[model samples]
Target: MMGLILLPQHVLHSVVHAAMGVLVFWCCTVLGRSQYQGLAIPCSPEPSPGATIPAMCVNERYLFLLLTGGFMGYTYSLRYFLHNMNCLSFPSVQQFKYLQFRQTVPKLLKLSCVQSLYLTRNFAAVYFFLGYIPRKWIQSVLNLQMDQHLPPLDTVRGLLDLSLFYQIWLSGVFLLTTWYIVWLLFQIYTTEVSRMDVMDGIRWCSYRGLLWTDLM
Candidate 1:
């Protein structure tokens, strides 16, 4: 039985990893595009009453909304891979019960929360570490004027700088984190092979315990 299931499991494992890689690449593209245009705008000083807003600053919320959507897409794809593994690892009748157990358990609950938190944290952490902290320290040391009335693009430029360096750095971090997650999931996939053996042991223990109770 293990031999029969092995081939399909390998195929599924490959497919899941491939899909995750594609999603990661897609996410990087979307996020890069969104930030590139906005971050390119230079910090413009106070403008006249009729001055036009920079193109990058306009419709800003829409870009972030798109970025959030792309992030969610990748996250859902990851969840699907986990669910697929559960299905492959158990019989149809037992699968539902196991899934419920996994979902409701505190450890799994913490895992889900951590995964979701990491998704949001990556962007914020990159900005804080590479953009915000360095920029603020430099400005303070140089005694540069902090313009309060600056545009959105200008503010982001001040925070993240107009250089492509931060963008590249952030993208590298994001991609590396994604690759780590894919590798971790693959480890889980391999362990699932022995899941049935553990289940059998559990069943035998329960049966023997019940028999002893009946004999007494």
Candidate 2:
């Protein structure tokens, strides 16, 4: 019997890389242009500092995209962790079976405590990124004018513009910070923590975070 494999967390690892590629392309190429429009496009196609990336300083938006992409990648990891936590049934130990594991049927499904904790953090991100950071980014458009001396900065409808372009990036960033919490909770009471040393589905080596792979 085989349920969905969730451990060693390699299933959507490709998604993590794909998201990175898409983020960079969208931010730096497709929407990227010669002129800066308030929020409709965050950065220019230019890789060099001459690109005049906005957000008060040149190339600032590029920094934001990289940070945002990194956070998004980590968030995907959280989703993978949560999937493993919910799946209680061990169906097939295919991952470790071929690896010469002592037990042919290692934990096919794993519901570890650390994964549960990650799930909680993911839910919290819904509020942190979309709800809070968006408002902050929107407000920053107004605040930015005061700091930077660029003549166009004063005239652009920065408020309305952000929703179209730059806010989209912030939304992703909200995805990252939230998809990104890692800390150990010490429960003096009963602790419901379990870990799978080997995964059933993982193939082709992956560095699923230490917090996930390491036993709690």
Candidate 3:
């Protein structure tokens, strides 16, 4: 009966992870294109007599939107993964007994540690790439002036300075903390159940009961 219940949940988890992987892959591709091809604005040809100048390309804006969307998608997927894992419950004592009681606590702890490292690295990357370096590069490469008065460089700098990165960083941190709490809950659950097993010898009793019931 536990197997019947757990099988579907495990299958659903696999499906969700697979879908997220695909989404991440697609976002990487789009980001690559936006980085290489989209950021370069072509020089406009000189206008003939009375000819109107072509509108400037807004490629940077488009790239910002794409990257923001990607970050949001990845964050949501991570949140869903943690949420589902945390909510899983053993329906009966038999199901709980079958859980790899001794190993579950260690496994959950290891997974939590790994997840924390990954998220920290991701946050650091965002902080460096988006928050610090890109802004500096935009100011330098675009030759932006720090003056309050309107200037062409300042206008260009404003166009390039989409704060999507900071927004995404805040959101990612929120989700990561939420997931961390979920992992903590799983750890607590495992520890409590393991201690209970020591007190009750639940696994051996459950197995013996199952054998006799099956024989009848």
Candidate 4:
């Protein structure tokens, strides 16, 4: 599918997935060491006497969970794209029509469920990773310079600009691919219901949220 091979999109996805994988691997290794011998590997500087290295190690486990969840999400998203394209690429119209009547509905529903689960897991991972990691650790890890006051408006503007750039790149690919997938779903739904009007309903509901977001 043209949606599947969107140049550097796949490459960026691969890099993020690979980085997550490596982070998970390292966390697992650290966790193994910590579990077997009660060894506490120091991460950054000790924040306090009671706040031991083991705590940091545990936090690393949470980070690993986040990364693992992200990796799973990205992996499943790729699989969903592949499956959708495969269905679309079927040579025989008869086979495609038959699938629309029967197989496509169930398959798409299952994929939708899996995608939702993966997305939820990934979000959960990010929540815990961001919430639990110590601020000092984050600063050191990111090599970020701290400001005494809140960052200036210009700094905020710059951050927003960068975020928008990334969002446009990622979301553009996702939306295009998802639109085709949704189109296929509509075809299957219409076939089952014997109602072409359902497509308008589906499209309206799907784009409604996007419309609101764009307006905001």
Candidate 3 colliding pairs: none
Candidate whose TM-score is highest: 1
lDDT for each residue of candidate 4 in 1-216, tens digit (9 for 90 to 100) = 655656587656656654654344344445545321222233444457775432232232233333443455366446545665434332233345555546565665565555544554454445444533443465467554333232221232322433333322232234333534666765555545342333467789878978999999
Per-residue lDDT for 1-216 in model 3, tens only? Answer: 345335666556545544543344344446555332344343334336585753333233333433443444454454554566545554334334335444355664555445544653464456445543544465467654222332221233543343433433343344344444555556556655543343357887998899999999
Better of 2 and 4 by TM-score: 4
Candidate 2 accuracy as TM-score? 0.27
lDDT: the better of candidates 2 and 4? 4
What are the clashing pairs of model 1?
none
The weakest ten consecutive residues by lDDT in model 3 span 145-154
Candidate 2 residue runs with Cα over 4 Å from true position = 1-56, 85-147, 150-161, 164-216
Stretches of model 1 off by over 4 angstroms after superposition:
1-62, 75-87, 91-108, 125-216
Candidate 2, residues 1-216, lDDT tens digits: the string is 023334344546635644763465355433545243233332233246665655433333333334444444555555545555323443333233224222321221122223323433443344334533543464466453222322222133322334333443434433433332221111111132333456444532344555457854
TM-score per candidate? 0.29, 0.27, 0.28, 0.27
Shift of residue 196 alpha carbon in model 2, Å: 27
> Model 4 off-target regions past 4 Å?
1-6, 9-58, 80-216
Tens-digit lDDT track for model 1 on 120-147? 4464444444444544554566444333
Model 4, position 205: C-alpha lDDT score: 84
